[model samples]
Target: MEETISLQDLFKTLKKRLALILTCMILGVTIAGVVSYLLMTPTYQSSTQILVNQTQQEQDQFTSQEIQTNLQLINTYNVIIKSPAILDLVIERLTLDMTPGQLTQHITVASEQDSQVVNVTVKDPDPHRAADIANTTAEVFEEEIPKLMNVDNVNILSPAIVGDNPQPVDPNPPLNMAIGAVIGLMIGVGIAFLLEYLDTSIKGERDVEEILDLPILGLISPIPESDVNLDNVVRTRRKRR
Candidate 1:
């Protein structure tokens, strides 16, 4: 037989498992908060920007063609910035204790659409090291592009600097807790429904009628012990009289 649940049944299930759902939510948020604030390592970010443009000797005035070419070159520049040729020099200059591949993973190169400026961002556990990596990568790219591409078009637009108080960018506790809470809620509701489906014991007259498919014919109420004792005393008095 197919069983159908109505809205009232759903409400009843939720009410019955309300404590379980709340506990799961609390556990989820607590775990997320702990992991974000204590277990995970916080990463700090720093970025430097470089501009790609023709030198004064190469071009006296900027043309539409020159601007378009520089914009297209930004894509190639982004890849070259993260390549080992650039990262190797950056690692050597900054004395970073990591391979070119490892260093490459931490660096991100991007530019706005149709813009000649490229941003090189780096993330690290140490704020000073992150700033150093960003600046060193930009400087190395600027110095080496002339040799690699045969053009001195790259120029440092802004160097990354460590502020008086740097903040870590990763391990956002509030965001993590919010995500954890959502996941917890989903799991809790699922478990609540599952438990409701598994429970089959009859608890009331409606459950008995549903299981047996028959109408109740009669009702037999149990006599209370006090009422039975009073009846027995009245019978004894009548017998004595």
Candidate 2:
């Protein structure tokens, strides 16, 4: 026969295994906290902004075809900024120990839609190194773009500055711990229900009756000492006769 469990039964099951669930949750969260603190590496990020304009004048060049041409080339410039040709020079200028590809991996170039501004970001383990990389990459790109593209269109709008106290970007402890706790709780609940489902031992008289499908004739209580002695004497007399 198919058996269906109700909400009450489910609650009862969880209540019965609440201790196990709580233990698992605590252990899982503790492990997660410790691992997050010990095994995770911290990363720092620095960013600089560059403006892509044909001339240094502050006037709006909205109607100029040259401005539109520069806008179209912004995408190409964004790609070139992360290429080996540019990053290689930046690496040599800075005397960095990393390869061109490695430097490229740490750099990001982004530009807004219909805007002439470009944002460059660099991430590293050291805050100062991150800032230096951002600044140098922008500088090299500014110096090299004129010769390569025949247009001095890139301008360093802002350079990356390190504050008195820089913040780490990766290994966010609170967020990691929260996610770990949630995952642990889910696993704990799943394990609790799984154990309950696998348990098939009879726990009560109702279970026995249901399994046997027989009438329970009677249930007797223990006899008193006097009644037991009287029954023994009667049995002895019957044996002698």
* Best model number under TM-score: 1
Tens-place lDDT per residue, model 1, 50-113, is 9887554576677998777776778888999999999999888878789999998898899967
Cα misplacement distance, residue 44 of candidate 2 (Å): 0.7
Error of 2 at 22 (Å): 2.2
Score residue 174 of candidate 2 by CA lDDT.
76
Tens-place lDDT digits, model 2, residues 117-221: 899999998999999999998999999988887888788999999989998988787777777778877888999899987887887665566667766676567
Candidate 1 lowest-lDDT run of ten: 53-62
Give candidate 1's whole-model lDDT.
Answer: 0.89
What TM-score would you give candidate 1 relative to the actual structure? 0.85
